[model samples]
Target: MLIGDVSRHSGVSTRMLRHYDALGLVRPTGRTAGGYREYSPEDIRRIFHVESLRSLGLSLKQIGRALDDPSFTPAALVSDLIRWAEDRLARERELLERLRAIDASAPEGWQGVLRIVELMQGLNSASASRRQQAVLSRPEGVPMSVDVLAGAVLTEPDPHVAGALRWALARAGGDGVAALAAGVRSADVDVRRRAVRAIAEMPEAPDATAALADVLGDPDATVRGHAALALGGRGVTSAVPVLVGMVVEGTGDVEAAEVLGALSRDPGCADRIVTALADELAAHTEDSAVRIRLTQALVELPGTTAADLLRELTHDDDRAVALIASAFVGVLDRRSTEDRDG
Candidate 1:
């Protein structure tokens, strides 16, 4: 076939076919009487092969080698092509995400766009200090999306940066509770802990509390501790049991004790707190350390409930427990006496 016929049939441009001939990748082995380039059946088939390989992302040079080199196999080269394509795809996706984030920021100008990009970079910064500064240096008059802050909070590893992110998320609040709630369900123990801590700052009380309540029984003690503390701080009486368990186990016992004490201020919650703590102490009667922690937790209670518990602990079997309880009882007595005198 002539070059035009070959081009028309194979869909390969004559210009490209001539270039391919020049490169010796696919050369016609015949000529017409008029001296125009003519392609043999074998050459036409080779053109189809070259086009076929090109579709697989092979460069012209690679395709040349593949069609010639008996030792060359498609497997290794195809794998490399797949990897290259995957990397390109990942880059494209990331660019798309950045564009979406910038668009979502609704930047008013180039400066605003740059600032949003900078903030996004900062949130993903490897240095905790940079992330901290990024959150702290949030420019006034520029609104950052709550999703950005929430995402940073969920993954932030440094305590200071994480705290700042949490603060930003709370201030930027709108649908932030959802992100942090998802973090609470993370399988990573640390991520779950951070998620709950960050969620604790979210003011979407109903949603945040619901998410927190879901994780209250997490097997990771730290995760449970964070959830319990958050709920207790919010005065949720349902946290009473977790807080009591925290006190008995001595994990975040002091904070738990303080929250328990605060919750006990409510006449309704007071009896429950007192009863839970007392029951734990009694149930673990042989555990001196448990009893000690339980005794200290009692001091947070008011209206004589803690003092009454302390009095009972004063004559307990463990001498250390008795001494500690007696000392607290003395302090309570002095405070009680002074209150009456005043």
Candidate 2:
């Protein structure tokens, strides 16, 4: 076949076929009377080999070596090509994400697009300070997306930076709740913790509350504690048990206690909190420290129920529990007296 026929048959263009001939990669094995290049069947087969290798992301130089060099082993070259293609794919994915974010921002023009890009770069900066500044210094009209802020919050390691990111995400409205929920399901403990923290800071969206409730069963104690504390504060009765457990274990016991107190304000959940605390007290009677923490948490409950529990705990066998409960009862009594006098 002539060059034109081979180009038509193989899909390799005429220019590229002649270039392959110039490189001595697929020279014709014969010529016509008019001195035109005539490719024999073997030459056409070689052209097919070069084009096949090119499809696998091999450069022209790489393809030439693969077809002509006996010493060129395909394994290493194939591995390198795989790595290159993976890198290109990763870059393409990143580009698509950035474009989507810009699109979501609904940038009005080139300036708005530039602002969005700058904010994105700042969020992704290696310096935590820069990342925080990116979130904090967002332009007034640029309309940052919640996903960008949530993504930063999930991966942020610096405490101050994470707090700033969470704050910014919360202020951005509940749009980031989906992203934060995704973070909650992450295998990374830190990511899960940050996700819950960020979600807790947002306005009470049902999705956020539901995600937090689902997290109560997480194996990570700190993560469960965070979720429970957030859910309890949201008046979620299901969080009462986890909060009660935190009280028993003394993990985030203060926040747990406060949230439990808040939940107790609800008439429906007040009795449940009291019962859970009472049960934990019985289950771990030998654990004085646990008893003391639970006793301290009891004071957080409203009305005379907690006072009554404190009165009973005042006579308990554990000296520390008795002293703490008695002290709390006395405080509650003074507050009651002051209320009556007013």
Candidate 3:
């Protein structure tokens, strides 16, 4: 076939076919009397082959190596192509996320867009101080996209930056709750931990409360402990068991005990809190440390049941536990005497 017929038949443009010939990717093997390029059947087939390889994202140089080098195996090249494509796809997705966050901010003009972009860059900066400044530098009274703030909070590894993000998120109020809730369900344990910590500081709105309640059973004890304490402070009785468990397990037991103390202020919850603590005391009687911690937790509770539990603990078989409980009993007595005199 002549060059014109080859171009028409194979759908390869004449210019491209000539370029392929110049690069030796597909050279015509025949010529007419006029010395015009004439392509043989094999030459047309090579053109199709080059097109096929290009479809797989091979660069022209790589395509040349692939077609000409007998030792260049497709396996490694294909794997590399897959990785490159995946990386490109990830970049695209990240860019799309940034665009969406910006759009959500509803920037009034180019300057507003520039500010939002600056904020995003700050949040993503390599330096922890930069990320901290990003969150702190958000202009007051100007609404930032809650999703942006929540995203920052979820991935922030620096404790200081994470704290600042959480404060900003909480200040954003319930708007960020849904995003943080999604973070709570993230498979990454660190992300889930961050999510719960941020949500724990949110106002006790139903959505925020529900989010904490939902994660109460998280596999991470730290996550569950934080959630339980947050819920307990919000007067949610469901946290009682987990709080008692924290006391028994000695993870954040002091904070757990303090939250339980606050929860016991509710008349209906006081007996349940005392009984839950008593049950743990019964179950963990063999663990002196557990007994001592539970004993001290009982001191935070009001009413006779807790006081009674303290009185009983004073005679505990563990001498250390008994001594600690004896001291607590005296403290409670003084509190009772002071209440009566007042």
| C-alpha TM-scores of all predictions | 0.88, 0.93, 0.92
Where does the lowest 10-residue lDDT sum fall in candidate 3? 172-181
TM-score of 3: 0.92
Q: How many clashing residue pairs are found in candidate 2?
A: 0
- The candidate with the higher TM-score, 2 or 3, is 2
Candidate 1 Cα misplacement greater than 4 A, ranges: 1-19, 34-41, 204-206
**Model 1 per-residue lDDT tens digits across residues 160-244:** 9989988888777467777576687788888888888887777564588888888888999888888888888888888888999
Clashing pairs in 2: none
Expressed as tens digits, the lDDT of each residue in 1-342 for candidate 2 is 888998889898999988988988889999899998899999999988988888898888888888778998999988888899999999999899888887876778898789878878887789988887888887675567776777778888899999988887777764778877778889999889888888888755657887788888999998898888877777788888888888888889999999999989988888888988888889998999999999999998996777799999999999999999989999999999999999
Q: How many residue pairs collide in each prediction?
A: 0, 0, 0
- Residue 25, candidate 2: Cα error in Å is 1.6
lDDT by residue for model 3 over 1-342, one digit each (tens)?
999999898898999999998888888998889999998888888889989999999998899999899998999989999999999999999899999988877878888888878888899899999899888887877656677899999888999999999888888654678877778889999999999989888864458888899988989999999899999988899999899999999999999999999998988999988988888888887888889999999998878889888888788899999999999999989988999999
Predicted model with the maximum TM-score: 2
lDDT of 3 at 250: 94
lDDT at 176, model 1: 74
lDDT of each: 0.86, 0.85, 0.88
Top-lDDT structure, candidate number: 3
